[model samples]
Target: MSSAAPVPGRFTFVLHSHLPWLAHHGRWPVGEEWLYQSWAASYLPVAEVLRTLAAEGRTDLLSLGITPVLAAQLDDPHCLSGMHHWLGNWQLRADEAAASGNVALGRHEHRLAAHALADFEQRWRHGGSPVWRELIDGGAIELLGGPLAHPFQPLLDPRLREYQLREGLADAQHRWGHTPAGIWAPECGFTPGMETGYAAAGVTHFMVDGPALRGDTTLGRPVWDSDVVAFGRDLHVSYRVWSPKSGYPGQGAYRDFHHYDHATGLKPSRVTGKNVAGPDKAPYDPELAAAAVRRDVADFVATVRQRLIDEHDRTGRPALVVAAFDTELFGHWWHEGPQWLEQVLRELPKAGITVGTLEGARADGYVGEPVELADSSWGSGKDWRVWAGDQVQDLVTLNAEVVQLALDTLDKLPRGGERDRAADQLLREAVLTVSSDWAFMVSKDSAAGYARDRAHQHAHAVREIAAALGTGSVAKARELAAGWCLADGLFPALDARRLRRCRDEHTSTVPTGHTSAVPS
Candidate 1:
């Protein structure tokens, strides 16, 4: 007699790792610190865990969303030099802490700093691309590409939107010698007709929040008539471990993120309690944190298994459950997060839940019928309000003006003047101005000033450069573009002439269904 097929179903973790173009910008309390901290505490440890799993012959483990902007910084010479210097400073700070008689924190920090320094020298000396290339080439992780600078697409000029998505994938191809089929869609932000752009760029699948699908995220659904799939994140499975109210990271036994040792620049306290002050929290103990990791790992595994089993039972078909999170959460916000992740990935497989990438899930026949996706994001209320709301309406207008200015200037360049340095840099500045990070900051009220200032600064650069090009002084235009390029030069692959061709082609190609606006 034939046996019934097992139905526990598929599971995968999607980590969207991104930061603004912070290199050569501010350093101390804001910019470079953010980069180095996430590098040391998050990227390094997470990469280590994935590599370890790969060594055991595991493949298609998770989908990793490394935005083009972040990849540029990780591969930039200036940022790598700064990262090295920062690691050296970390060691010296640890020595100072030890000299000041904080032996426990001092010793712990010293080891961490030393290990990070060695890791950077040995693996990251060439930059993060090679590290990612290893995983991608080995089939250990699926790469999810995004727009040139993680732009919030809903409010962007259609011409600029197509250019950004095309160039972003080109950026990935230049780095890894292949194009990605899926994207994270910068904060999971989307609206109707964006699917036409996705199809134009050859994107096959992308992510959205569960609420975007009205909470029916058990499978991937096509948007309208477009074949490009929209994968809804399983928020119940994800938020159970990182929600606003309660999560594993909030346990009193885990290391506290908010509290830090002012001297050594390291966190040395446990959460202690939900309402406890940072200064009053207990000293962090590895044993206790380890215990919490174990418990949380078990709890999370149970959650994934139960979610998969329940969905399968209801549908009589295996479902795909993707738990997505910010990559910075591991080792950066939650110190033991990487360890917990390693455990989750390892345990899920043993629990009869197949751990695989989204591509893998789809290949294994985990897909559903098509549906018209609503305008939504993974932000507050699964809507475009976070990137287009009244609070960020100023940024919305600014992005519109900058994108239009960029396209008009690039479009009007004297026939064959497309490859001009001024034109290339104008596109660069304009792309940076549209970065989704700005609206995200304003919406969340976190570093709103910095975000606004960055957006305006880039927009101003675009305006000034466009004005210079209009002056008939090609020399002065080149000078201005070069100056800005020195500070904000990313996307080394940006070709004004090539983009012009694509822009011209894409303009006529945009379907009538391709209208982009905020949905009320």
Candidate 2:
């Protein structure tokens, strides 16, 4: 469209933003603090960046995946109040740090805290749904949604998978008055027949890791006659910005995410050098960090331009490159990441490179011919081993049992009356139990114990409520369900009754082909 022949056809930046249910859960070790930290450090600042761009009339190319569970938390009244209070506490902490002689760090945090507080009080007082809705409606960000609870869908029961996917889409519609045609499939995970389910739910496009296509990830291609396109992440580009061992974040000039000032609960040092002890680290100079952002931003932009040019020449057409990453990586993990994003977005267009949303690419007729995709995920080996391997076998079994019990309990419920709160609560706990986070945490040993306990607690809730019902004590079951709902309440949109059992399976909209897999 730009008449520049070698300009990369399109680049879509997909950011998946999610957190396990943590609102009414504990505070310190693995609970509300996790939520609040990401909120203050990531979501608020990221949203502010996007909103500013939107106000300046730049509305294209950014795709954000806010999982339904995450959406539930953002919209919940409890989380809104908690986030407000948390911001106030953040400012107070910064003030205390300032008085305690960490003046530079104190002033820096105090500014961030004050800005976050003002932003929250003025714009976010109602709830985050409205903020996200504005972005979606304004076309500043393309909204990518997923299952109600973000189940590792490939391993989930097919019927519940459909139920979760459909309900998840419906939840988006309920919030913003429009159903998203594109979804960020949880974990970028795919099982062969699952595309039919996506088509059935009206999803027109989704993402997967690059290796899912045997590393030929230059374009969005249809999977086996289904018009729904599957876009693969260009890991060469994504990992250049964020990989475990090395990336822009690990650069010496950036803020050190691990170094904490225990006295003030603040990070006060830059990444002085690789693996250097926290105490030996030098003070964080904002000027140095700012310079790193500029250098990284320029380097990343050049990387994209060259990547697109290479594909354009090889394929004789404008190529599409999707660089996907977690939304938390921006302001939370990388500190200057959001600033880097802002700069890259602003600079790409000026560089004569085409940048637009995945849908924009489709509308521009940029989709290539269909390709056969193997079962894959964005994990270590581009396989499902992370969620269903020896390391997490116990979690795998726990998830299967919880899901089966939930389906059985919901099926046995009497149909068509007032809402069945007990059965609804049972389903909520079951889905939460199967969140891919637990298995991932266990696999990575990030917080295995806490992940196991959370999964088991929710699974136990499902069993207790189901047992009470089976014992012919409806009153007792209701009481038990009410108690669980008090803590596990997030998706008010879920109905156990919506669980779909396949009716003959074949669909004209979705053409079923065959299954494929790669070894761990």
Candidate 3:
């Protein structure tokens, strides 16, 4: 080790990037538009920031988790063409706004659209794999991955959970040629003994909520005597920028996410006040937002500095503070987020606050004593309620039923024969049915109808294909499965033959834990 003095604490940012499979889905209010918006507003700019920083010799800037489902879309031939068209449409909309006399909004959007188009053409034309590969191979960031469809691990059937986790890791390996050791567990939802499953899948580390650690998030903690560690997000520092009630994005100078100019399809107003109506919002001023970004960056650096000193003083040891957020928060939900991120990454080091990735934190000994973790998530109430609550009980039940049928049908399929397209599609539909997003959206009432519709459609596909296979109508089953695969064909790597109900792999035998009403 170098003879340099240890800093008070280290800080790392974890950005979870994910979206349910949306290829060939409907376009507006909830479907492919979600993918295109995030790709344009978040992925394009975020990749640019990392690329710029990496060119300047930066490494280990942050840990980014791109769920397997989302990765598949980003690289899919269909989605790439869709994104390209989306960019072109964006420029056209800007031109329309200008011709219609909304000059300021038009000028702003035109510049952004032009830049995004250039970036897409230059770096992303082939697919997201190359874009992500450059960052991973260059050591610019640590890529964290999760299950095939971001299922809620706690409620997922053990066999399905194991299959998804293992397949998810393999998906990452296939995409980037490096299997991630860490995962941003879907919903940050976890149950006890999952560490055993994680270990079996070669995952060395994963993330949970702050309260899961009983609020002692000084470092990563090993779970249940295993080498696998769980890192709890330090909510004190994390919430300062991500809290739903108040965060940097909520500042009045920032652009308002809810208000949009219908003609040009652009957000042209600043958050004038917390309770102000959309029409009352003031026109957005980039200069003012830039100032706010600078102020917030300084404030964040100061926050991290104070946190480091306070932690060091309290523990008599250097500390680690992990601030995790959704990657889409940058430039997507918060228009100024990418700028804020760039400034914060640059300012933290200048302020003598160490910035590193989660992988680096683990290797640098930012770990704590072993602790028995429980059922928890970084969601409403910091428990499983967001995914398994009363509002989503139907979805919860549906997921269980679909998973069982898919597993049973796959198990009964003959071994070592031509690949059964029906079986693969059944598993695919089953996995899609259990995606945490459906339940989350339902529970939160964000497009609950859409969530329910999606859940049921997938479940129906599972039931249809399973029935056809059960009745010895092999051709009929394949036909049904082929029809479903037209829409949900993201993971070509998923072969039903590779799946089995292995029950003895996980070493930890602790019973599943219960959830509390603790708020995250």
Which model scores highest in TM-score? 3
For 38-103, candidate 3 gives per-residue lDDT tens digits of 999999999999999999999999999999999999999999999999999999999998889878
Candidate 1 residue-wise lDDT, 1-520, digit = tens: 3322344678889999999999877886677788988998999989999999999999999999999999998999998988899899988988887889777777877898999899899999888999999999999999999899998777677777888898899999998876999899998988788898899889999999888878888888888898888888898999878976788888999888998788777787899998899888898888889998999998898888889889988888878898999999999988899999999888877777778888777667677888888677888766777888889889978887787787878777866633688899998999899898989898899888989999999999999999988777779889999999999989877878776776655452212342343445
Candidate 3 colliding pairs: none
After superposition, the stretches of candidate 1 with alpha carbons farther than 4 Å from their true spots are 1-7, 503-520
**Span of 10 residues, lowest total lDDT, candidate 2:** 506-515
> What is the C-alpha lDDT profile of model 2 across 1-520, one tens digit per residue?
2433337577889999999998887888789889989988999989988998999999885989998888888888998899999899889989999999989999999999999999999888888889999999899988888898888888887777787888888999998777988999888888777787888889999988898877767878898768889988887888889976778999999999999988778999999999799999999989999999999988988888888888889999888888999999999999998899888888888777777888887788878889877678988777887887789889878887777777766666666677777888888898889899999998899878888989999999999999987777789988998999889877786777665334224221211232234333
Better of 2 and 3 by TM-score: 3
Q: What is the TM-score of each candidate against the true structure?
A: 0.95, 0.95, 0.96
